[model samples]
Target: MNTHAQSPDKLAEKILRGVGGPENIESLTHCATRLRFQLHDGGKADQAALDALDGVMGTVPQSGDRLQIVVGGGVANVYSDIMSLPAMRGSGARPPSDAEVKAAMRAKSRGRFAWLDNFFEYLSDSFRPLMGVLLGASLIIAITSVLEAFGLIDTRATDKSSTWVFVDAMWRSVLFFLPIMVAYNASKKLRVDPWLGAAVMAAMMTPNYMSMLGSSSEVPGVSCTTNETLGSEQCVAKVFGLTMQLNDYGGQVFVPLAMVALLALLYRGLQRLIPENVQLVFVPFFSMLIMIPITAFLIGPMGIWAGNGLGSGLAWLNSNAPIVFAILIPMLYPFLVPLGLHWPLNALMLQNISTIGDDFIQGPMGAWNFACFGATAGVLLLSIRHREKEMRQTATGALAAGLFGGVSEPSLYGIHLRFKRIYPRMLVGCLVGGVIVGLLGGVDTEVFAFTSLLTIPVFSPMVTYGIAITAAFFTAMVLVYFSDYRSPEERAQANAERDADERAARDDSAAADVREPLAVGAATAAVGGSGASAGSPVAAGAPAPGEGIVLAAPVAGRVIGLDEVADPFFASRVLGEGVGIEPANGHVVSPVDGELVTAAVTGHSFGIRTKDGVQVLVHIGLDTVQMNGEGFDVRVEPGQQVFVGDLLAEVDLDAVHAAQHSTITLMTVTNTAYLASVEAHTGQDVTVGAPVVIVRR
Candidate 1:
């Protein structure tokens, strides 16, 4: 409702802190219904606490790497909030810095040629939302078909009856009005003027225009006239050699809209040449005159032909190679349903079926429908054994939609995508089902009027329809059950990390009660540095005379001094040298207490000076300069001074691994000979801020 644009980083930050910070989450993902996350520890999550916060609908654990938190219709808003939080500002989260945020936002922005993309994306986003509308209409059509098949509903007599007529009208309205719904969403995505888009869509749906196209016949008395005939004719027509044809540009073809867009641009350009005072008055008048007739005669007819050609091609493919439809439809339907393109094709097919009575919808797509049903059933069955309570519920909902409603969104988003490995299995099941249906000579006697599984009965009595559907569902379930889809090691690692976090949280809580006073004094000492006057021998564990400036490890890892580098690049480095730690195998951490004077041009190396005047060069890995800084996340700005252990950068070990390169952290004092000597810390696996080096003047 608030039309003002929000800063995405700020919004994401807010949501992250609200959800117990980044440390609480193991992983996160999003879908239409909610933000799904896996927590390090469910006990530490505070689900009730999260629900009490604003913007959260509800929280439920669904599956491995699946935690559902309903954020209602404003799910995107909440997602933004989570992404903006400082705690969630991990390697994956885009920073709030102007350049970074803008870059990330640009990726999600509508592109210049995004009309087709928006049309498809909008259709996919709304596919599930429109399920009810589609299902209800289809069910009614199916019921009528069943009744008609059994002689219970008399088509000839009922054609005049109000009841039958009402049913027919309902079916027609749903089909005809679908574009109106699509237009609304498409306009939203394209950021186009909604009223104008809808107006264009409405014009395409006009009864007279639609009727003309459906007939595929020419307008009466509007045939091509020869110049000689016109001259000799009784009425001497002014317009010659033009035939009026019914317009067929009712679907999602882009050419007519493109023409309109081009006309608008041309009109705007032309306005620049008009006299300033009369521009407004003449611009609209002249532009419409040029645009309207040209659009009607040329662009409109061309768009109609394009739309018909697409429809005809699809019909040809299904008719000639129906098995291909059987194979492809089910496989692609799930993937496309999530993005919304499948519906347009379905709409076009239905329209074709209605007009020509033997389009692809009744042939190949019919088999595909059954295959999809099987995939949904398979997902539902596999969900039964899921460990998470929330996931089980979502799975049940998905199954219901797939089994009875014929809606694929629940299964596609909730089940298939979450268990991504199961997707191929679902595809295989659909393929098998399609093959069976095709072998049995299945036919779609009625157009799918609605989107529900209940409507499946309408395609009954075609040999093997029941068997095909059943086999597909069972096969999908069996495949999901037997497959070792999720890795055991990953799950174990997640559990271990969660347990450690819980323990740490508990320890922090317990220590907080007893150490509050001490912590306050330490904070004061750290900020004010006034406690030296207290004469407490610089306090226990405080920096000594020679160690007055403790060199904090810039990164998290096992603390090691410069002497560890075996590469010739740093083997000759001496004491007072800057230190580096291997933070998780190959990640390099900063190794000094000074301002970041420079970031290397390639970003693989950085220079930092110790507080006591030791300049240190910390390079992440040998030949990492060749990496061009791809694995590094720089945190410090130039001229910003850091504490001994403040994080300067985060090196991505995974990325280094992917690149097949070693990540050896190096800390060298570019001016090390200036110091008396440098001593390395005694322990292994030292953390940031551990006394890694002692520099004596």
Candidate 2:
């Protein structure tokens, strides 16, 4: 991947054509790998053309006008390039951010079971935002557990010192106040007043409400019984001639998620029934008055009952057949995420955390995430070997997002879905990882956290979780990397493309030399002959006026297309078309027979104007001009005439390196708009006098 020059500009143009151009793109955003687009009409996109593109791994047309272009790793660059296009210049073509994409994706869960979708989303959204804080709290739990293991603290003591009590409350706060947070988020998700939702849920946890339940001591209209399963006293209050189940909804996630869904329907119906004149005051009053009672009497009890049943079911499976339970979770997730079926399982995770004090689902879920990223790692290795720049970037970004962020959408759509072979290889890693965790007594966590490398410390028996995930990551990485992701035909096609690109670059020097008249040497190769054999070098010559222009590399280095520069300006090709060289030596030379137009006093850049009407800027490194000529020596001034390979400046690369500056010499034709075409020859190394770009007029 590093060997090739990433060129998203041209790739973006191809993607635009395949995607039915800028007009069709209503909105676009990239995650880890794929370019997600919400189009005006998905039917207008050319599937075959997109699939056939050199950089594109594959495509997925989702329900409605949602389309995904699998561009693994380099999607960010491609996105930038697409945004910089002249057609996308207008404000109307500007796409939404990734957050908007996620929000929209959450919104599109529809159909007869739309309420069910909204229900699951309510739970997910409620809990999702709190993950970081919850994970931090979980780590504190882990630390205390570790201390308790060493007898450093009497963790089980009923009476605690002020310091220990404060320490315990740190983690307990997350669980104690969970209902209020869930209520707020769920209400907002359902388009209701969040504060009202919090207020209603808060009533259940109040001292007065708990007091009415009658603890160990007896009270009027209250009764208590021992619950065999929980081994805790269950209490109830008799109100309005009916006994209502009294539950501690402190850490209960399901109750609020479900309760808010019901509240939204009741609230909306009330809005319609009541007249608009007095709606605002009465709507909140009637909705809360009616809904809070229904919640306390019915929904609250039902949610606890459901959570227990689901947790007990999974717990039974985990107890009896741990391997099957573990394997099934990871395997199902791969299929679940794309169709949005995974939300229910995610909800189940929160339920487990709420009722059982932890969730096992996230433990096994790590295997699938690692495996997905592993497949991407495999794709990246191959892209580097065969010089597929776009894929390399796509895979790189997706893998990083996976390992650190615990996200999977990028790898799933970008590489796995596009190349069917990845799924089988990736699943095997998942199975092995799950099997490893299962056989080793299974991994568990005390608090809910995303399964990421950073959260590994939160899992109990850290050794087991570490080994299992490491096995998963390496297993998938090795399988995908060694066996390769592409089919034989696809592999051959990619190899051919790489080989052809290399040959074209090598040929550019000799081809340009042979095509032009040799006034400098008074001799030239056969003008009308067929293409020269491979291994030909640039013959000395003076080009005819109409002959295509040849731009030489200004320094010896590995030549890459402008897309790999990590600067949006160059990667997007706003200046012109060109190549970037990671300079191996320190000297800068003239890349063309041109007159100097300008030269910066800082000595980090240059500008040249050719007799052939090509204006080129040779920028040295990224933001090196900020160095203020500390590491550079300028030899040429403005209006100086120079030929190809003529000395322009001598750079102190050691100084540049010490100063943390890149030495990639970027030579771009600044006036490309007036030309017929400017093509940069990339994916190969070059030296001074070697053809790095071909400008056709």
Candidate 3:
């Protein structure tokens, strides 16, 4: 399945149909598992059938996307395939009349303002993927903290004596150098020069004169035995040759982040003012000369002081309220994973952990990690017995990643975001696990060697870790199990609908034996015929029926139930009835109607008993009988009906795709026994609502 071409609405429809259409879906939620659809009845689901589908990995009844499906790592690809199916066209999938299409084209042409809106939408969507990069780096920092806490290495020792030296280096690199990565991505998004952004980031990293001012000398205090300067009364300091007792300020003063901001502004202004020919050399010179002192005397010192104050306050909190520190860190940690804001704080925390040989922040974050693990486990366990093969596979993959790899992206982006209903359960599990660890005084002094299931063994010796992991798992499992899943009745109803759709599709195929072929002629000559006389077909200059025709699917979906009818006694038997197509959902449109015909009794199938007496029957899709035609709206009636361009039925694409049947439009000639020859369309992809067959008599 080519997923790239599919639309989201179309994919949603296909999924809905596979699960027995909308009738079977009581409710739907997506999470780190499969799409967790609460079915009205479980019986309606054909786990094997869904599993057999192309692009489906497997399905599970319980966890992950809820109906956990492992659609491979390229599950998104599968989703795209489903979405592209015409049967899954969503709310927009009406069999548009020619007039409607014309109107839509006109409307589209009128809206030149659409490009701006599209540009913003594109940007917003692009931002989601970067979450993984930021989170990955933060996780590395978190891990370093855990490692440092174990006393495996001396944090202060910069030499080989300290394992922490390496850890510290890693943490610093990720934190201090983060702006480059962010800038690169931002530049890519903006379609600008990434290196320019990198240059800006580099400037921020450079040391300033303010740092030198901070490193100045401090005043000496008089001790009990030392009154040397006081007794002589020459305790004078000179500033600009004016002698006075001076308070010495020494060593590495803090520079304000605003200093960097000011420098950036100055640089930009200078660049503009300088002549383009000499701008590169002169701009830097002027900017450095002017901005450096201003930064040192003002912005630099203030910023440094502010940073120091913030650091001091944090330290005080850690010392005075250790419990609060422990609780707050874990609780808020996950929130930062979604946004790109947690890096700075995490960097500082890791540094403190290494420098002080004890970090309260890292310890708490362990609780958060364990909670996520537990939630994943819960989903996996619940998924074990799931009926849907695709869901099962997805859950397994996500669960494995969560448990062993410590990469929750697969789960978070693919499943969790969709299954928002599971959010509370997962949150509660995390909270319970975190609180337990906090209360137990769990201390994570060392980072794990790796973020994987293998590392779980390393943490086994820690009592608090053990307790936290256990609590998290139990909580997650309990919540998942007790939570209401799909009801049995809903599943049954879906199953019935699916069965009906299938039957209707079969009936349509049976009716194909009676369909008559459109007249054959040159492209222009055919246009003169009654069928084309109204106007040229939407896709003009299409190949005529007789010259080795290729039948492309009118809609996207699986090719379901291709068969021929048995008939003897007619000389035209060589013209077999055309193929039976079940679009992924019940959505149907006129393949070709030389004349108005019978609207099938089931309302699931329609017969365009064409003018030539070659009856063409089109079942909207397979297994729609159970819906009792609930979502299908007939636009044209039997006998009083219309031309090929007429709107015959508007099937609910979403409802059909959800039902799990391909919503392919079938073109079957009911009286194939009368034709002298029949040939299949040759193309790989035929446009929907286009002619697909030619009959010869």
Predicted model with the maximum TM-score: 1
Mind giving the per-residue lDDT tens digits that candidate 3 earns over 442-528? 555543233344355445336676676667667766776566222232223223333333434445555432211221100001011
In Å, residue 327's CA in model 3 sits off its true spot by 4.7
Q: TM-scores of all models?
A: 0.45, 0.42, 0.37
Q: Cα deviation in Å at residue 131, candidate 2? A: 4.2
TM-score of 2: 0.42
Question: Best candidate, lDDT-wise?
Answer: 2
CA RMSD of each candidate after superposition: 16.1, 18.6, 19.6
Candidates 1 and 3, the one with greater lDDT: 1
TM-score of 3: 0.37
**Candidate 1 Cα lDDT to native:** 0.49
Rank candidates by lDDT, best first: 2, 1, 3
